[model samples]
Target chain A: MRLSIENLYHTYGKGLAFETAALKDVSFTIEEGEFVSFIGSTGCGKSTLAQHLNGLLKPDSGRVLVDGKDINEKTPEAMALRHRIGLVFQYPEYQLFEETVLKDVMFGPKNLGCSEEDALRRSRGALSLVSIDPDIFGQRSPFELSGGQKRRVAIAGVLAMEPELLILDEPTAGLDPQGHDEILDMVLALRKNPKLSIVMISHNMADVVELSDKILLLSHGELLKLGTPQEVFGDAELMARSGILPPPAASFVRRLAEKNSFFSSLSPALTTEAAAEEIAKALQGKFE
Target chain B: MENIIEVKNITFSYPESEEDAPAEPTLKDLSLDIRNGEFVAIVGPNGSGKSTLAKCLNALLLPEEGKVCVAGMDTSDEDLIWKIRSQVGMVFQNPDNQLVSSVVEDDVAFGPENLGVDPAEIRRRVDEALKAVNMYDNRRKGPHQLSGGQKQRVAIAGVLAMQSSCMIFDEPTAMLDPSGRAEIIDVICDLHRQGKTIVLITHFMEEAAKADRIVVLKDGQLAMEGTPLEVFAREDRLREMKLVLPFAIELADQLKARGIELPKDIVTEEDLMAALESLTAGRKTAGEAVPCA
Candidate 1:
């Protein structure tokens, strides 16, 4: 489904003595099946923007359009639209409350009034999608699992709802490298669904380079930059101003340019593989 | 090098594991000495007992069969545990888990007060600690209002207020973002520069690259221990342990495998460029910035 947010403004403690404008005139769009990423410094309305996409929070001014439908709290269809968009929060394990993993995963589908047999089936399918063994872990309590495992289960619980637009807020935070590997793999594998759209927020530039198709930069609640990760990292001065560190590949290329005036300009590099390839070819030209 | 902390044939088992698990021990005859002012990092996969080793350093977890000495003080002595902890303050993974007071300054003061420091002395330490972590401006702010990175800075400040000679961080940046991790690392490096011994435990290989020495823990044993270059050069061993090498090292290794003339010592982006520029010197003309290792 297409999601368009236009001139959105949200303030906490409105009319109170301590009002804070978290988001101001924020405008962005995510087409169906597109992978969009929102990046900004801390408390710059990244999370606030994501919350408006699904009905978790309403905008004080402006509108959130889900397939041209306004998703305001006043709308009769707002509750149903909540099911269409699934959000796996920053730390989702905090929301889990069930005796068994199956029960936890079934929470979404069951809430949507699916029958027991169908809820069980959806829960099992979601469990398998996250690579968790259903038979082995279905009956087990979530508290007994490791922090990473619990997070996956929490994500699967959201997946059980079959959301068309999947929003993940720092899905790999606080995980070990291996756990990070597993989490990203799960996120990438979900692309096989074909109909699903993914919107993820990440502070790690490396991960963002790997995942995002469109990178939206939010600086102090403003739409600073919206383009490919390559475009964003290419501007060294702006990146430095925003306090966003370039991915190591970009940094390496920039460093090389500084020393060798012959190599005055280079395309943006993301992964280590790309950097090595581009640098090697550039060096060959330099020597030959 | 003079040893500040010595580990001698240590062995330990957590109390609540499976009874029939054969008592495999968390630390198996592990022995090492941390030089007085060295910056060391311990890295291993989950459940590898790197944290267990950290706890043992400050007497939080005593070794069942061996001894851990911090500046010549034995860990097993009950009366000396508090003194040892003061000498080697620790910062844990979760900042929220350790901070006790509501305000930033109050939280920092908690550590000095615990040692029964003089009121005026505690006030001095509190200011010094906040300044050390760069959290002096937010001293009056409530702990809950600060961001995750700021909270971690407060935690570092808390540990600093105790006047510890050495600091140990048990994956202190695990819960923080890239910026937060950078901030905490900067604090650790500053402390190291100021002549305080630092031992940091982390899963991020890139972070480990910044350390002077690296100790790899596996199943509660010392699998590998050496400088960053020495340990990272052994890609096969690190991979087998489910540990990833730094991106720079991986890129260098990839080029080396492809028959390019990159050196084994190329562990950083700067080093990689240096090696490349030397080979491509003829094409590089005036004003072309050439890299140097």
Candidate 2:
């Protein structure tokens, strides 16, 4: 799905003593099959914007368009359009309340009015896509699974909806290093569908750099910058201003460039392997 | 310094359900000591028993076999449970769940209040604890009004008000954003400077690198234990345990693979930068051609 947000404005506790703008005049477009990431410090309205994409929140003013059609319209077609965008919330495992893992995943498809058999098939497919063995874990209670498994099961619930565009809010938050990698791998595998677009909201800059095709930076309810990972993370000053750090390799190269002229010629690298390769080449030239 | 906590061959397992015949022990014969005023970080993959070991530290979950002692008080002794608990405070992963009262100061005061400390003493402790975490200004604000970092600080303050000599934080920054994570880590470091024994259980290798000592667990057993320099140097073993190295160490490893010689002790970003700067500095002094700006 091609999603676009135009001049989105939202406020909480309007006209009250503590009235605050949660999102303000934010605008961005997400192309089909593109992996987009929304990143900013906490309370920068990343989550607020994610909700808007799926019509979970009504914008006080502005439009959310899915495939050139406004999703906020009061029509059956608009409602179905909104369902095509699935949002997996932070700590989504807390929402799992089913006796069996398969049943839990089937809940979303079933709720969307799919037949029982159809929902079961979708649930099995989703679980397998997440690398969970549906045959092995299908009958087990979700609560009995490990923390990482429970989180994946929760994600599978969203996948069972068969969303054209999926928005995950901090999908790897609270997971161990291995679990974190697993989730990222699952996301990559899901993209194999070719028709599924993803919008990830994450604090891990490294993961953002590794996965995102395009990045949307939000700062205090405003769309600060929208560009490729290199474009967004390349600017050290902007990252500092937004209260976020660049990916490790980028930050290291930037710091090195600041301290020495020799390192200044090296571009900011997003991954450690790339940074190491560049540094090694530079050192080889100097020594040889 | 003397040991504040000692776990000797402790084993723990959750009760089995009807479907699962028997549950494996979460922690198996795990033995370790936390020195008084020492900062220790426990790291492992999920189900590696980091949280279970933390619970065992505070007597929240007693070991099924062996013993856990806090400052010479045995955790298995029913009467000493409260005494041990009061001495070792725990801060959990989720900030919202740990908070009890709507107001920040009220929440901080809850611990001492439960201990039946007089109101005057509770007031003094609350003020000191809130100030310590740098949340003095937000004391009057409702917890819901604070950010994730602020809420975690308030949670730390709640433990501080109880005058616990040792604090066990179980992935306290797991749910926080980058800035919030930094805030909590800063508070933890500050507390450590104040001579409070710290037991930090975290998955963030960078956070663990700050601790004086690091312990690695795997399959419910102690896999490795040493200073950060010692444990981080063994990249192969750490990878086997499913733990990622800190960014600097990971980079250093990659550099080493590319035939770059860096000091083995490099763990933090600062260490890596200094090592690279020195290497480049030597080349500059050798009269290498300067690259264009």
> Chain B alone: TM-score in each candidate?
0.92, 0.95
Residue A267, model 2: Cα distance from true site in angstroms? 2.3
Query: Model 1, B7-109: lDDT tens per residue?
Result: 9999998776443344677778888789999999999987788989999999999998889998899999998988899999999988888889889999999
Residue A25, candidate 1: Cα error in Å is: 0.7
Off by over 4 Å in 2: B282-293
The TM-score measured for candidate 2 stands at 0.96
Worst 10 residues of 1 chain A by lDDT: A279-288
What are the per-residue Cα lDDT tens digits for candidate 2 across B145-243?
999989999999999999999999999999998889999999999999999999999999999999999999898999999999999878888888778
Model 1 CA deviation exceeding 4 Å by range: B17-25, B276-293
Residues A187-286, candidate 2: write the lDDT tens digits. Answer: 9898777789999999998889888899999999999899999889887788888878888888888888777766767767889988998888887765
- RMSD to the hidden true structure, all candidates: 3.0, 2.2
